[model samples]
Target: MEQSNTLLDVKKLEVSYGHVDALKGVDVTVNQGEIVVLIGANGAGKTTLLDTILGINTPRSGSIQYNGTDITGRSADINVREGLTIVPEGRGVFTSMTVTDNLLLGAHHNMHESSDKIERVYQWFPILKERSDQMAGTLSGGERQMLAIGRALMSAPRIILVDEPSIGLAPIIVNNIIEILVNLNKEGYTILLSEQNAYKALKIAHRGYVLETGQVVLSGTAEELLEDPAVKDAYLGA
Candidate 1:
């Protein structure tokens, strides 16, 4: 795909924390309206890559381009305003705040009224609306995940970075969340999902990349990855 037409492009990206190198010359792209999944074991640098893309962690080298603009050193707040939002790992909701309050904060950068956006989020996750006045900390794991994704939608983002949406949930709840993400992608929301559940991630993804020790060791269409003997053995336990 051409760089100009891509929604996000990471070229030779590297990142480190102090003396520990996390991402090593990683490259990936998310086209408009596509679901791209990153699959790996724990400590494969998936979270580090997403954090770097969102400017939560600065890149040690290389460039990050979003919608044809360089956003390498942009702040997280600015990146969110510019339509890149992340529903981070651990369902990073503001536990101390009301569900409604958390959603409102997601739209802080927008100067216009957020009533419409709030309504849209509620429509996407009606359970959130039901628990609108409840403290975010009190919600169950699945509800918290919904609230997190709903909060990101409040920003009206064009692209969403989701890390481990299936973490710590029952199998049924994980399936529901994956279905919601697929539906969101169908509705033209570009997504880059980082996951440790390779089987589940491949089921909903259009394409996938497998990372090992900070390098992309395997990549292909989801169907291809699902059937590959190596992927099946290492990730799917087939």
Candidate 2:
């Protein structure tokens, strides 16, 4: 596939929680309509990086450029409105709300809402449409994951940041979710996925980054990282 143009650029991003550094000068980028995977173990600052980009957590230093505009230090709500959306870790769905309502919250920023986006989400995950009126808490783990991704899509973001998407899901459901994400990428949505499941994540990603203690230790095409002995021993369990 021809490489899409750059959509997001992060240069030497650094974040900290008052004395404990979480991200130390990390450089990452996501191109238009490409799926970029960040694979690392727990506490590697993957989530922190996404949070900083989304403005849920402010960065101590470094710059974030989205579509060539500076977005560092911008509020979370503003970022969402500006076409940057994040489907956070743990599938942060509103359990007490109906599935439809959760999706509406994602579209709150839109001045002219479209039922077509909702319909598209349903088409993507038929189960969500089946449980549209059901409380999110009543849905299965896979259903909740689907709802999370669907809700993010309601915003119609130019880039979607997903953190630990496969965490706490069965292998079959994980495969399903990964396939959906891959399809989304093929449809011209740029995706930045942070995952612990290195093997599965690399399968569909165009490129992969290995984060170690908040730093990018390795980065290459997915096939190259998958074949690396170091990555195989540490993340791939080979």
Candidate 3:
């Protein structure tokens, strides 16, 4: 209940791919212990923003600050080592590897404490433990997502950037994922959730930003966004 500090700050961010602009002067922030949702349609720059922050893509301009340090151009591995990690959109687990092996890959940087980190991840996704020796490619969509998230946790990250977690998932499974995110937030993990399910995203968010064509069109507390007329018609079907 003491969330008051900014953990991640993105200022005037601009990113482009060859000739196409992906993020244009987008400013955003994630406070400690807060679940800040970014609701946008496909190609709205949500993933680009997350990726740019995680160092997957280089930004054309702007600054990315994590815990008050300017890390605009930091490498992904160093960023992960410094407590920032992402659960990519496609649940990019090692399909050929076993569940336990995949999780162990996440602890590559912190292998000195690999066992303890793996145990912590198991507590969050026991199905991972149940399927420890099973190949990741054979797991269901929901289980794969759990492994992706659990794998990120193995790095002992302070901020988790979850990209489109509900993509290709059933309603009940989406609900389960949302609840797991809420629980993770309660356990003190700051999350920046990029989601297309606007209503569901806003429901559990502390604050939210609405992205449109690489720009932030709206932002406010969860309650305000949920009640906004534009939000209802465009996203909630209200």
Candidate 4:
């Protein structure tokens, strides 16, 4: 995709917590409607990068642009309202809240004005609709993962940043979540995904980046990454 069409752009991003630098001069980009995967081991700064992009953590130095507009140092609320949303690493649903209520929280800034969007979410995950009145904490792990992704969709995000979506779920459940993400991309939403399940993530992704210690060490098409011997040994368990 062309630079003009890039939906999310990061340049020389550097983030630090106290004296510990989580990200060091990292750069990444996600074009419109593309599914870009970021794969790496623990402490590779994947979460920090996503959080920085969404304005949760301040970057010591870097530039973030969304649709050509500089969004560095912006607030999380503003970013969400501007169509950048995240399905966090852990299923961040409110355990005490009903399924419906947890989903509604995604549209908090809009005062619940988008019921149609909620219906669309239900259409994507009918089980969520079936248990709309049930407490979120009562749902199974896979169900909670679905709810997390569904809640993110409630915001009508243009580009979603998903973190470790396959963590702690069974293989079948992981595949289900992957399919949902693929379908979402097909429907024109761009995604920047961070996953430890490199095989699955790369299979669906158009392109991928390999991060090591906060910097992009390798970046290529999904097929390229899949066949890379280094990637195979490190991430694919080959």
Candidate 5:
């Protein structure tokens, strides 16, 4: 990739809710075709950062640039149309809706093309096809995660902000999710993953940023982070 091939760039971001600051001057970048993971504990501002990037949460001060265009504080719908999408934490599927209907909802920006978009999502997740007519509330956690990802894929996103794919999943299911993310990255989808499962996140990430109390405490190539004593002690439980 060229030096200028940054797909998503966030600089000096700060976000607050009431009097509590959630993020403080954070900087992160995801290059084209790269899988960059953000590792942090709960309340460490991981979700806040992703939400800011997706425009679900507005930053108090910062710049978010996508494809070289300044998209800071744009509405989430407009940002999605610009080829940025998020598979939110807790696998935000519409529980009462059928799998197919939920997938169709993702194509709100291109409703007329929704039917055409679904087959691609089904191909990525065949189980969703089998459960197409079934209510999403009936699906397992793993299946729901798949549906969430598939729904995001319906938009044909350029950069995917995935928040904690491992939450509430069994080990095997987490592995499956990780493999799916790796496969998607191989297919050239840029991914920005926020994971509290630090060891696993670092293993799959090309590069990583470690956040603590709304500040970026550390950042490096994944290999460098994995071998760092501080990372091992704090996050890896080594």
Candidate 6:
């Protein structure tokens, strides 16, 4: 891919916790206006990679380039201001806060100037507006997921890293989440998605990577991966 079109690029990325290496020289990239998915089983280092990219976990080696600039080891807040945002696993909403408060928190960079963005998010997710005064903790699993995506959208980010968006929801809810993500990509949001639900994720992605034991085992277009025997056996229930 051309450098100018690459929105997020990670090469030889490595991360560790004490002696345990969570990521092992992984390489992944996302281009502008595309949905790139990283699919693997639990403990396949998907979340670690997302966390590393978001600057929540420091990489021990290699480079992370966002918009062609090295952002490796930058603070999470700094990355946030540079139009990189993450809808973390488990829908990390503030349980004690109201829906509006949680959505407003996403625009921390310039709170006073973010009303328009917040309104846009509300428009994308009218349920959030309806529950504006309700505590975020009370929303159902699907509603919480919508709130998480809406909160991420409130920042008007160019690229969003979404981890395990379908973790604990019903099949119908998973479909809803998948539709929202596909729609976001159609609206020109570059997405790097980490998901265990390979079938659904790959269906919406333009390209995909299969991560195993902290290393990337395969990379190709979504159709290629879907047709691969190993992928079909391991993830697609074929």
Q: What shift in Å separates residue 127 of candidate 5 from its native position after superposition?
A: 0.8
Kindly list the per-residue Cα lDDT of model 1 for residues 1-238, writing each as its tens digit.
Answer: 3555699999988898898888889889888988999999999999999998998998989999999999998999999999999998999999999999999989999947698989988889999999999999999999999999998998989999999999899999999999999999988899999988889999989889999988888888999999999999999988
Question: In candidate 6, what are the lDDT values of residues 86-173, reduced to their tens digit?
Answer: 9999999998999989988898876866778878888888888899999999999899999999989877799999999999999999
Per-residue accuracy of model 5 over 151-182 as CA lDDT, tens digit each: 99888899999999999999999999999999
Using all chains and alpha carbons, the TM-scores for the candidates as numbered come to 0.97, 0.97, 0.97, 0.98, 0.98, 0.98
Pairs that clash in candidate 2 = none
For candidate 4, write residues 43-157 as lDDT tens digits: 9999999999999998999899999999999999999999999999988889999999999999887756578988998999999999999999999999999999998988879
Q: Which stretches of candidate 1 lie over 4 Å from their true place?
A: none
Better of 1 and 6 by TM-score: 6
At residue 100, candidate 1 shows an lDDT of 95
Q: Pick the candidate with the highest lDDT.
A: 4
Q: Which ten residues in a row have the lowest lDDT in candidate 1?
A: 1-10
Residue 217 of model 2 has an lDDT of 98
Model 1 gets an lDDT of 0.92
Supply candidate 4's per-residue lDDT for 236: 100
lDDT of 2 by residue, 1-238 (tens): 3224778889999999988999999999888878999999999999999999999998889999988889999999999999999998999999999999999988989936558889989999999989999999999988999999999999989899999999999999999999999898888889999999999999999998999999999999899999999999999999
Clashing pairs in 1: none
RMSD of 5: 1.0
Q: Lowest-scoring 10 consecutive residues by lDDT in candidate 3?
A: 1-10
Which consecutive 10 residues in model 2 have the weakest lDDT in total?
Answer: 1-10
- Over all chains combined, what TM-score does candidate 1 have? 0.97
Residue lDDT tens for model 3, 1-238: 3234889999999999999999999999999999999998899999999999999899999999999899998999999999999999989999999999989888778888898888888888888899999999999999999999999998889999999999999999999999999999999999999999999999999999999999999999999999999988898888
Give model 2's TM-score versus the native structure.
Answer: 0.97
Model 6: colliding residue pairs: none
